[model samples]
Target chain A: MAQTFSASELKQIYDFALDLGRRAGRILIEGVEKRTGDVGEREEGGVGGGQREKMNAVDIVTQTDLDVEAFVKGEIERVYPGHKFIGEETYSAGSSKEYLIDASPTWVVDPLDGTVNYTHLFPMFCVSIAFVLNHVPIIGVIYQPLLDTTYSSLVGYGAWQDDGKVGGKRKRLPLVNGPKAVLPREAPKGCIFSCEWGKDRRDTAGGNMWRKVDSFVNMAAEIGGRGGKGGMVHGMRSLGSATLDLAYIAAGSFDIWWEGGCWEWDVAAGIAILREAGGLITTANPPANPETDPIEEVRLGSRLYLAIRPAGDSEGETGRQAQERVVRETWKRVRALDYARPGA
Target chain B: MAQTFSASELKQIYDFALDLGRRAGRILIEGVEKRTGDVGEREEGGVGGGQREKMNAVDIVTQTDLDVEAFVKGEIERVYPGHKFIGEETYSAGSSKEYLIDASPTWVVDPLDGTVNYTHLFPMFCVSIAFVLNHVPIIGVIYQPLLDTTYSSLVGYGAWQDDGKVGGKRKRLPLVNGPKAVLPREAPKGCIFSCEWGKDRRDTAGGNMWRKVDSFVNMAAEIGGRGGKGGMVHGMRSLGSATLDLAYIAAGSFDIWWEGGCWEWDVAAGIAILREAGGLITTANPPANPETDPIEEVRLGSRLYLAIRPAGDSEGETGRQAQERVVRETWKRVRALDYARPGA
Candidate 1:
């Protein structure tokens, strides 16, 4: 049986996660700002200004990433001694890539999401913190320092965005005044689609990279183009951060987010937030069996995710049915991508 | 000969444009907010709510767009009676699009750039205003109301970003404290590239859509992949706003912006701001003759543009040379595109 927490206990954990996320955000902002300053000095011909040669863009592991992860891990351990912790930095450090999640009170954290955006000073990086109990995420908090925004949610409770002002009012998710609109009849054709070109860039035939590019083109082409596989989405946005992509979906700004290859820490917090806002998540690709439900097959460590925003009842269809319909439509345009977690 | 304005005259114009942009932004905020509310009501099953069926994403012309343009045009005409004006809404409404620019003082404006984003409630839209004299952009101001940020510049003067606070200090463009860094030796390899899918989605063989997707794939694939034409860029971002993309280039956040099929109004303000920050603008496609300079071949009316951020100096090479070198390298990977203005 799944363990459950009282509402009061969940609130306490959510509060702690929000605080921790903000602390991690400060570290990210400071690190990126310092790096920006260092780059400026280098351009101005300053010698020995703490500048290190970046080996490559994809492999930019800054001291800040380590620092933020370490700080968050230490705090969680100190505050909740009985809870387990799994972080991106620590997980990557270990050789084992088997499923780290289990039926326990655990904290999954991505200390610095959007590392490339951070390195480039793109101002989209964030700190994501999620608390999972019994293999299910129960609380989530994501803080973007530059934007001074925080997105937080608790199981059985709604999501909210805090603008980080001293006396600012927190806005409820789906930010719309009432129920969310149902998915458009044309589905992806009128939807704003979000995805990422992740770290893997191999272009072998039928490889992850090729499939991802093909999927993007199929979604972007005209409706009748690409041999009838075109989705012709209203817009395609790649913000380089899975956490923010999910947060935007919860905020009702992004209509859909389809991604593969990201780990649990990247989506755990986002998933919690998205779910609280009435959004749904399922497998990126359709199930082989015609009658299988995609949502039932999705796991936290699945690595492939297709998320849709809340769609309330419209045109004689239920909100859930509308979301499922759009998901099926999107799956048709997407070429299947294979991304197995280590030891999966 | 190009007409010149005194520093005092330019400053006054810049201040007026800034004010005009902010005023227009108010209308946009109101319009989007009202629409969000209306949609909420419709979703909640409220009867007779103010809702209209949108025909398509590319052609979402909200009343806000027309209102902002009318207000800005009226304000400009009132302030500078002798100056001419060309705006996105007005231009689109007119049947003729033959080189609207002339060697005269004029104001080119996109009252609402990123119309799709705005209609979808994405916060990346902005009001762009540019002042041109003798076919040269002299002053530019772009206001993003959602972020409460403003980017402005004057020819021969510096560019600045105002955070929209009553007493907030305006930061200088290229926001770094010192000189800007030169392009990476690997050119687009370490660059953060930004582009738009645009309104045109025609997919004929070798058409604009195919060429764009091919170019994007080439830029994103691993180096030495795609038959030795891969760029392997660090990150790819599509914010769905041409104006903000160029402003980000000026701010040194976005390293490169390669776009085709945008209008003069979509880029005039951003071009002035970027040039003031020491950035470069050139043709997106290579010139036929190897000896021809891409920068020299580019004109204000050119539908294709490739822009690079300010690069001060590095590794014994001048900033100009570094920029030119990157441009040449990028050209090798781009597929030529054709986008002619009507009646051109």
Candidate 2:
């Protein structure tokens, strides 16, 4: 079951994905702008699987989303035949947690990660493409067309970002890049915390939605709450775009992105870039210290994640210690309710 | 005291503010980029009034904020010798609420609205500038240099936006412009809700922090709470930029912006844009209808505002009715705990 591709061959595939992702992102931005004007008259209800147009309060699938998935799938197949595809718009039903069990080269794609934002013309959506080999996200690319920024990473090669405003120079993650580590500040003090309330508002107790609300309250509560342990974060932000959330954390703009109830495609690209940029991704479950846990223990499709940006340059031992202390202290106060479905 | 200026004179002042705002925004952006790199090692404590370096859990004041305010004030004085000014970085202590009572043509400015975000390099800060005559915001402009987008409006002239993308075309607001009005959908049901956890995190009951937590929980709660009314919004967003929040709602991207614990300068510019775009601004307090009440009833300096985007064209009486119904229903379920201090 050993992989047959050489390092050079893997690099070639990574280059292919980076180019294809950028092209698909441009298509998404253009299509979204053209379609935003007509959203006024579009009916609210629909159903979907393959371009199956479905609409709901939390999630919506537009033709553009499906089209982008198909286009990316087609492009990937053209470049590398026999590579399996797992895309959001056409993801198989009842494939939770075990979808990545097949040990083949798979291209995981969330052609439009933030479909809800895309529909609202919120400018927070993105195209997330990742190449997974042996269940590992080896190559990842996330392109945000509105911001004209692209984040990409090849496993072991490190993460990089190309911002349109900076003359499209590909800045290696942490801004300083290389030998310099980029440490994050303590939570709720100087940190910009990111999370989302996914569209799963079941009224039942211990439900995913219920837990998210509880967690948000706890994270935002005052430092010393009335007879409670409040995380007292500096601020809370929900931009409605998960891929960008992970990408931003990787880029050092956001200190942490805690998410749950999302699939593998939603985070694969971001996870790859994050790790490459010297960040760590762990379960959102509270009291779990990111400093001590090996990131390899992080379950890919656990539907929960707590991603922390790298502490600044490796040389500053004190700064790095402070960053880790924040992560530990923040986790001590966080209590994310379990979202695992019954008998999963 | 009736205003002495004619319509033409007011237009001239508005034009000058727009030009000044754009120039000031560029300077802020340049300064921010230059300063973001050094934030890593900058000592995290200081005190502030006029460029008094200060740091706190919620608010951070950098030199750039004070510099930008001074630059804008200087530019305005050179253009009109006697116009009074009230700006965030320079406002007198304890005069936060009553600074706008003067009947003169006063320029209200928040040189940097999202100081915390700016300090964190989060890109949610902006330059908010408004010209108020007789305590009425007659012209407003909000510029986000990071995105290079500008939202501006002159009373009676309507709202407009110039996105740095799309070849910098100055598209009129409401997106539809002129005859058509673009309305927002119902809240917590496909609606994008925006709010902020401002820097008033006093842990005491009935304090700003306590009240914000209560409101957020209520808004995000299930439609039929166990024993209480729930706002049940589609999703919640806290981008930490009040000016951008109001400007985005005025531009029709955000459906609603519910804010409290902010100042007049934070929202005056956005109020002008919202009104000019046919949107409605009312108190964040629930059960108050903007339709029956005069726009003047919107207490600008009250530090509490609830703004809603219009629903499409006015021709469809049924559509307009539906829009109003949503707002009314939303208000009924909203219960923002009062944060005003006793005998203020």
Candidate 3:
């Protein structure tokens, strides 16, 4: 039998996660400020000092990442006692190379998503916290300090965004309040596409990197280019933060977000929010044969994922059908990428 | 002989530009809100209505864009009666397609950049204004309404940013105050690169679009991939806005911004801010030969531009030399693109 969470219990967890995410956000902001010399004494400079400074910036990110993870872990353990926790930093520091997600209530966290953006002071990093029960994320919170925005969601409950203004209202997700958002007539052609170039940059023949580049070009090319594979999406955006990418999709700003080579923690919180906001998450690649292979729901452990925004009725199709249509159209334009988890 | 303005006069102009930018920003915000149904009544829905709704959204952007241009042009002409004006919408609406930039004191403006982002409510659009004297931008203002931030600069004066806080202190450009910033040891490696895929989606062989796609791959691939043509940059970000891209380079968050298929109004303001912040702007492509063709300064009319962030002394080289080295290294990895202006 599975353990069930009540609505009130989930609300408590959501509040806790929101609080924890904001606290973690402060640490990230402070780390960036310290690194950029916004709040502390300046570091001494010398000839050939660029390398040292670069190392120092990396150190700040690492330290802040560790600090946020430790703080969140400690708080969760103290409050929830026996709940399990899996964090990016902790997992990387552990000796065990393999792990499993069983029937356990667990917390998955990316203490600092977009570390590169953090180091560069690009203002797109965030703290993402997700509570999973039996391999399903039920509670999510993602806080962006620089933007002062908070996105939160609970299973069976709708997602919400706090715009971080004094006395500001917390708006429901899919932000189009009353009416349902209708997909563009041509779908992907008028859609805003968002994707990230992850850490893997290897470009071997038919490698993941090659597939990504090819797919991006295909999507941005003219409608008749590349033998009709061109999508000619309204825009292509890479914000370097998968968390924000998913959040934006949930907000209905980004029409689609496809990504590969991201860890579970990077997408867990975002998945919870996206699903609750009426968005869909599926495999990044399409079925090998539509006549035979059915589209699969992306698992938490899947290294590749595709997210589509919430849609309303369009062309005699329901919202779900519209989303599926978009997914299929997008899949047709992109090459399938292979990204296996370590020791999977 | 030419007319030269005094420092005090330039300061007055900068202040006026900043004020005008903020006002234009408000109009942009209102337009976005109105289109998103945040500020106005909802529209009636119908079956298969996606195309009509999209047209409505595009109408909002066009109306807002024209409104901003008209507003800015009116104020500028009223204040500086004898100053010449060239705006994105005005130029497009005029009968003559050819434009000339002589020695006149002129205002060049892109009332709204990133219209696609605006229609999608992606929050990266802005109002850009530049005052050009003798074919050089002397005062620049770029205002981002969604972020409530302003970036302004004047020739012979430093670039500054106001963080849109109540009583927030204005900070200098490069955002690193005390000490100068140093470029990474293997710059282009540890640098954050920003670029845009403009409206030109035509992918002809040996054309600008193909070159851009190839260059992006080289820049994002592993250092040895593509037969050592790879750059392996820290990250590649496409925010879909050239004006903000250049402003970010000036702010030191984005280390490099290489763009093509943009207009004089799109870059004039950003160029002034970047130059004022000790950054460098040159042609997007490299010179023919290291010993022969010298690097040329990017003109206001140069549709292609490459911008590098402000750098301090590094590796026994002065700040300017360090910037030049990064530019050359970046140029080595990217293919030269040709974006000829209409009737050129």
Candidate 4:
């Protein structure tokens, strides 16, 4: 059983989590540099004897991952003695989707969200931590140690960024760091978007791999679907970090992010931060009939999400209206992908 | 005829260019922030009176790009009055491919290399500068303003990075800031590669856009054309900046980069820096007969480049040999794209 904590109690946990995240980030940064030149294990000789763990050919894991998960779990356990937990490292075999469906007040964590990138010394990975109440992500914190940046928030509170000394400023989310967003209704022509080429390259029919190929072609095609001309958005990028991709959208650095096949841990913390920043997160495909399929039925494990950055009133339409138009337009382009919640 | 100078004279130019890059970077950073929150012009309202120029839906020009180009050109003219120049903003309209064929000592400049990225306020853009002597890049400097990182080198001299305060280090390339390179024979599986979905989405039979789709599928396929099964490499990324992409390869931050359709200005500086770092730059597709084709003939504007980071003898083979093996293997995977030099 999980204990029901008051808002004040949750805030305390949130504060502790942020500090824990920064310390964990330091550990990750140190480990990352060590692995950069250590690619020998897979080839001929490697950096003497570094331990390399692979959950799959493309999905890699490392000692740092296990160490970080242990640290986060230990810290949470020490503070909230009765809380339930779901984490990437401790995830039981064959139960990838089982743990995330419950309505408990559990801590969902992906101590290292972009392991492949981390192994390659790429700088886009993050440590994602979230507190979910009755299946809702209520508190979230994501820290990218290499860049010394953090994105955090509580459900009803706002999201914030502590962008270390180089940037030299603390900021609210939807980062006022750049120009206000310009989202045109014809997405492919006016917006910059992001998606991932996930590791699962099982190319069977209905297997996620072929769908990605089709999406890339359709999105970049000179023409749109079935007889319609394409929206021809500005561009698409695959930066390899799910946590940062979500956080970037939340910060309004990107216009939209559409992805499929990432699990709950990949999105739990980000959903909280994104929502707090006034962004919208929807299933990659819209409800077949808006009146018949309620948006409330969308779940984290649905494995497909289309996120949009919030706009300000300066762009002619209200921010919400702009977000809706972009989403509706984008949804039309992606009608081929089916990401409906497993049973709903 | 163009003036020929001693190595010392080139060094002076290199030092000057580095300083110029820093100054230009400061100007870009200033302009970038001003444009943030200024996207109102396209829709209804916008950031008050700031000029926004769009060469196309995907290519944008800002006052800063023009200002930086003029600043660079003026400073060069003041110091070296007779040098010829080729720049993105001033490329005498309609002759994009005409200027690079000559052998004059010219200053090739891409004042803003990733304009679309800059316009979207994405952080992958850079200021790329190179001094080409008789079609050979002799001095190069690339500065990424937002990150405050500078990558520079003179041909035959080594590549170096002034990583600024955030990194608090000055170092030689392949960034012995970490481990030495470890390249494996199975290119895709061992290396993290990068390319671009460039704005030229022509979809014609011999066009660039459709080839990207074919290459992505072939590279990520479970099996190859030859009898062997597929080589599923770690992953591919599209970071949106051709200049930085090559610079990162020079720094050994990424293992391989295969790209086409970028111009001389886009690659000249990076080519010089990469060569200085002891990396290999080859055409994306191998010659019909490697025994008869000389690698040295690969040019800056051939527009199809396949680059790999050099490795150390500690990794079983020498860096050059490792580069050859990976390139050979990767070349086998990409038979769909035709990037043979136009008259070679």
Task: Please tell me which model should have the higher TM-score, number 1 or number 2.
Answer: 1
Candidate 3 displacement at residue B7 in angstroms: 1.6
Considering every candidate listed, which one attains the maximal DockQ? 3
Which 10-residue window of candidate 1 chain A scores lowest in summed lDDT?
A41-50
Measured against the true two-chain complex, the DockQ scores of the candidates, in the order shown, are: 0.32, 0.23, 0.36, 0.24
For candidate 2, state the interface root-mean-square deviation in angstroms to 1 decimal: 10.3
- Residue-level lDDT of model 2, residues A1-344, one tens digit each, is 94668888888988998888889987787664453332222223111111111223122236678788889999988878889898887774445545453568888999998776666656678999998888778789998777777889988666777667534455556542222233433354556789887766666676776676666666667767634656667778889888889988887678767887777899999988887777778777764554575333456777778887765533345434545565565566556756664322
By DockQ rank, best first, the candidates go: 3, 1, 4, 2
Q: Write the per-residue lDDT of candidate 1 for residues B210-232, one digit (tens) a residue.
A: 88888888888899998998888
Rank the models by lDDT, top first. 3, 1, 4, 2
- Using DockQ as the measure, name the better of candidate 2 and candidate 3: 3
Docking class of 4: acceptable
Candidate 4 lDDT by residue in tens digits, A1-344: 54477878877888987898888887787574454323321243222122332122122237788888898999889888777878887874344445345777788899998886776556678899998888888899999876677889876556777666335455566653323444565665666778777776665667667777666656665654324635555677888888888998887778888888677888999999988877888887656763344444347777778898856544576667677777776666664464444443
Name the TM-score of candidate 3.
0.92
Candidate 2, B1-344: lDDT as tens digits: 84678889888987888888888887776664453322222223111111111223122246677778899999999988888888887774445445444788888999988876666556677899999888788899998777677889888766777678644656566542222233444454556788887766666776767666666766677767634556677778888888888887876667777887777888999989888776778777764553464333577777778887755543454434655555665566555656573222
The digit string of per-residue lDDT tens for model 4 on B84-192 reads 8888888745444454546777899989988867765566789999999888887899998766778998875667777563344555665532233557556667567
lDDT of each: 0.79, 0.70, 0.81, 0.71
Q: Which ten residues in a row have the lowest lDDT in candidate 4 chain A?
A: A46-55
Q: How large is the interface RMSD of each prediction? A: 6.8, 10.3, 5.9, 7.8
Candidate 3 vs candidate 4: the TM-score winner is 3
B252-297: candidate 3 lDDT, tens digit per residue? 8898899887888999999999998889999897677533466688
- Count of steric clashes across candidates, in order: 0, 18, 0, 18
